[model samples]
Target: MRISIIDTSSLGDRSYLIDDGGVAVVVDPQRDIDRVLALAAERDATITHVLETHIHNDYVTGGLELSRLVDAEYVVPAGDDVAYDRLPARDGYVIEAGPMRFEVLHTPGHTHHHVSYVLRHDTQTAVFTGGSMLHGTTGRTDLIGADDTETLTHAQFHSVRRLAGELPDDTEVYPTHGFGSFCSATPASGDTSTIGEQRHTNPALTSDEEAYVENLLAALSAYPAYYAHMGVINAAGPAPVDLTMPATVDPDELRRRIDTGEWVVDLRSRTAFAAGHLAGTLGFELSGSFVTYLGWLYQWGAPLTLIADDPKQIVEARRELVRIGVDEVRGAATGAIDDMSAGSALRTYRVTDFTQLSSGIPSDATVLDVRQDSEYAESHVPGAVNIPLHELLARAEEVPAGEVWVHCGSGYRASIAASILDARNRTVVLIDDAFTNAVELGLAA
Candidate 1:
């Protein structure tokens, strides 16, 4: 069997397409099925099976839609209480698709119903670990609930050991999560690894079960708020992804939307957004973390709109939003900021590097560190107030009255915080620089 990776870097997850002979099976596809279809077409393979390892908690699954489109069998874990029809996949059940033979293994860690697929063809063997045994760690056990975290963590330890014990040392490991995903119990290491490599490096393999559980729990950080919606949508079967452009809103309409407290997001670079943007519009630059942060802080089902320099940017941003089930993008505006300003003055903020911060900041300025609580505890600027970016919207009232200077690990998140403060009519300056520079320049205490 030949395997192809379908990476959705925005969410730090990967889907897989494995083909043997002329038949193919897709595993853990995102909501947008067009990319999977295109891959199958390019490979001259027919999709005969769409498999979901579990009801995902990070993004809506496209397995059901893709199966219907290709007339393939939709396979889901037998233990899940899903709403749609599916082929129930259970442990030790073997399935055949052309030359590929899949043996299902019930690995309940990430979610109670999660499973992994071990594929065998000719002389080669590989395992598709959806969220179980990741590269250097296991999938987080806390998504289900705080009450079940310890139970699942124990199960996770045994599950990883089972895979390591049963699978051959050379079995190539392909996991769907842990590629910079918050789903990981800890940050994943390396790009690719084998079962043998994992036995040596993975925390589940190297540490005792209790030690592993304690370390994993201690390291878990805040996940996106949108995650609460993904499992529900996936269990109910997600709607077909809509990638068509949203209605174009004129400058007047854009202004009205912003004035009415609607979500009119600016999808420009941090530097560009910091320089000038529509007053009251949010700056969630269309970058890797755009979907993640926006989904985290967004009011669910809100009538969203986008502002971009080009129509193509909005199109790309729309695709990202759909994966997280933020489907109510009501309108878009594309072109120069002046054109979309609708006769109002564009808001602007000053951005500077950390070296300037090291020299001196205004005595009356309040230094706002927008990194997470865990990140703040590691090292931070002396006397800087810590309000994580995800919490800024709800805690905006906590910011002190002064010229507020906001910053994060990189300037991306700080730009977001800066926009929020600017929209609130607060005097703000954005520290648009890497946090490492702050430590290197003796700015962090």
Candidate 2:
């Protein structure tokens, strides 16, 4: 038996390709199925099953499309109301692929119909616990709804304990979420762990059940805004990924697109963006957490034109964007500010350090904390209003008039927020310094 772990580092999602004697099964694949297909081809294996542990809320899955591409059985959980035709998988059902046998265990906590698959061949066994259990923690239970938060947490506790109790201690465990994914309650310690190790170290297993639920609920962090659209898109079945590069548009076309109220995302370094960028273009640095922030800020399915430094950058950016279901990449514009500006105007914003703000904040300026709610709650400048960077586009009007001074955990998010404010013609000052220096800088927290 051979298992291939395909990791999408940008989203921290993992898809598994398990092959036994030239027959393979893919689990929880991302939108891009090429890698999985290529791996199967390299192994000289024919894919016989495509399994979805649940309807994903973080990224669109390629299971349906992959199944059609390979002529494999698309197996989905029994209770999900997915529109596509699939083999409804039930609890305790066993599936066979070549020399392997997979037993389905209904684990309903991350979602109403989540299930884990236990693959067995001879004396070796491996469990694929989609979002139910992690290496050091369990999946967050609040994504579905607030009403189901407590109930799901309770279910998660029992589900986790059941897996730990029922599975042999030596069984290898694999989970889709938990590797730096927001879907996890906390970051996982590593990619793989044994049932015995998890039973001893996992928080969900070690803590008291009631206390675990309370802590899990309390520790739940704010997920990306694009998450709201993922489940709906997944349930309805997303179109196959088009890996074609977005068309390259000239300056006039870019101007026309921006003039018509389309998103012109500048995927350059924050320093380059702060120096000079096209007016009305939103600066999202391509170097740091590009996909997370872009998905957070962009309107789902909206026509978007990317501005990159080169063809390579555009290709990388589009790959990241499509994984989150941002498929309407109209085209790309690549060049210096002079080349892309045409006759249009260029804009710049002022960046300041935390020490300068500590000395004195302008009386007319409103300090905006653009970090997530949890980050702001942990420590923030006194009198700073908390409006996460993701929500700023829709809630910009709520920010009072005057200059807007923005700061985040570091300078990255603050720069993005400052660019948004600059595009709106608001006088903006970016606090570009390490957030860890806030206390030493004598800023009120």
Q: Best TM-score goes to which candidate?
A: 1
Q: How well does model 2 score by local distance difference test?
A: 0.89
Best by lDDT: 1
lDDT string, candidate 1, 1-445, tens digits: 6799999999999999998788999999999999999999999999999888889999999999999999999999999998989999999998889888899999999999899999988778899999999998889999999999999989999999999999998899999999988899888888788999999999999999889999988988999999999999999989989999999999999999999999999998988988889889999999999999999999999899999999999999999999999999999999999889878888888988888787788888899999999999999999999999999999999999989989999898999999999999999999999999999988897
Per-residue lDDT of model 2, residues 1-445, tens digit only:
8989999877877999999788999999999899999999999999999999999999989998999999999999999998989999899999999999999999989998899999989999899999998889999898899899889999999889989888999999999998878899877887679999998889888999988988898899889989899999999999889878899999998888878889999999887888889988898888648898889888877899999898899988887887889989989988787799988768887888888887787788899989888888788888999999888988988888998888998888988898888888888888888888887776747
Clashing pairs in 2: none
Worst 10 residues of 1 by lDDT: 353-362
lDDT of 2 at 194: 96
| Backbone clashes (count) for model 1 | 0
State each model's CA lDDT, in order.
0.93, 0.89
TM of each candidate vs. truth: 0.99, 0.94
Alpha-carbon shift of residue 121 in model 1 (angstroms): 0.9
